[model samples]
Target: YRTAAASASLPTFLLVGPSGSGKTAFATLTERTSIAQTHTSTQPLTIEALLPSPHVPASSHYRSPGDPAYERSRRFLLLDTPGHGKLRHYATASLSDPKSIRGIIFVVDAAALAEEPGLNEAASYLHDVLLSLQKRYTSATSSKGPTGIPVLVAANKMDLFTALPANLVKHQLEKAITEVRTSRAKALRDAGAALSGGEDEVDEEREWLGEGGEGHFEFSQMQEIGTSVSVVGANVLGGKETGSVDGWWEWIGENL
Candidate 1:
């Protein structure tokens, strides 16, 4: 039980995204250092992963490579949650109580963001994740606020010719999330009108993600809530014999 307790306390990074976005692939790669055949996951999988060498964990940069403390600092857990709509409660559950969570790695299929349906699906899921973080930040009882959780928008599958570039991916998601935010507000207002109650006003404000206003949603707004969102592009498969995810590892190391 002591071993289990120690493992449970390891820093965890939540892996979430839409179906077929390579969340499992990345998890597999992190565990084994090579890609493996993956299927649509219906349940959450937790794997212990160590930060690869050459990239140093931010917390242990001063320690020598061979030091035991340095080695321990490189250890963390990757909580890969199912991306299917029906199974997203696993992801939502983790977000709701993220005590040991170090960060969130939201994988996205770069090519899929090129189409409307895919873009909208990804946007809606992402909007909720950000809003959850925003709610956590606002509802904290401590004066200093809860520790911020950063999000890495991992733009996977860059090898595909149709894949949108990283910059475009960021822009498209921001624009789509803006539309989602607008629609959600309108929905709340409509529902409140139907109910004819003053209590609904407070709920609407709580539901709104980021700053309130007419301006479109930008990831920068999340900084106000102590969350930083970054979009980095890399192919988890098909780029070469071994797909590139060095950028992702570096980001993880930074957070670690």
Candidate 2:
């Protein structure tokens, strides 16, 4: 979960959704084929200020499918914004570099959340992108404490069918991480403030929103069997703890 020693101001990831929820191949199909790590040369990682507005639907751009010089250097600056309620009316996302917009994935389509979770519209665009990400990182970390911006709501495709099934997506992500850790520990114990997962859990949580994972994922119920680990996206097509979760080696490890 990246024990931040430094080097965290380089995360400009924003990939809204709607049409073909792959967000324009998420940087050459999952960041150059399942999140790159193959070195070469010619540099191709410098995505900044990705403005996406025009009715949020597939605004393609996934460079290096096999040509156009490569060398990626452990890079990740993807942005395919657009598809926020089919444009031509309401809109947002136009705030320059708030330390690289830290995080916001919001890419869900799970057969439209199994046909109706909130009268589906991707659950009203994931509750308006989680209330605009808890009100823009609680006003950008209300005096800098949320630690370098973070937010990730990825519910993408779900293998394009039958909707959620990773144990009902880990019982709806363990009931929203136990209601966002007791509502941020009762809003920091009613003002006294001093928590992350609130008071104690030891692992200061690494990934929940700005996914890619590090640690923290509760919700179980298929215990009789063995091997467990879930919450979704590991090429899931019915994978309750790595069983036969299909390919991409289980893509939902956000921050891990």
User: What residue runs in model 2 are displaced by over 4 Å at the alpha carbon?
Assistant: 1-26, 30-103, 106-132, 137-152, 156-167, 190-256
Q: What TM-score do all the candidates reach, one by one?
A: 0.95, 0.27
In candidate 2 the C-alpha lDDT for residue 217 amounts to: 27
Error at 70, model 2, angstroms: 27
Q: What TM-score does structure 1 among the candidates reach?
A: 0.95
lDDT of 1 by residue, 1-256 (tens): 3397788888999999999999999999877755699999998999989999999999998999999899889989999999999999999999999888999999999999999799999999999999999999999999999999999999999988899999999999999999999999888988887788644553777899888777889999999999999999999888664357888999999999
Q: For residues 1-256, could you state the per-residue lDDT of candidate 2 as single tens digits?
A: 4333323443456655454444444444443424433222122233332222221112123333333222221233555555546550222442233345544454555455554442244434443444444344545545553333233445555655565754564455445544554454445454443445355443322212222233442422212111122333433223344333222211221221
Q: How does model 1 fare in lDDT?
A: 0.93
* lDDT of model 1, residue 75: 88
Q: Point to the candidate with the largest TM-score.
A: 1
RMSD to the hidden true structure, all candidates: 1.9, 17.0
Which regions of candidate 1 fall more than 4 Å away from where they truly are? Answer: 197-202, 241-243
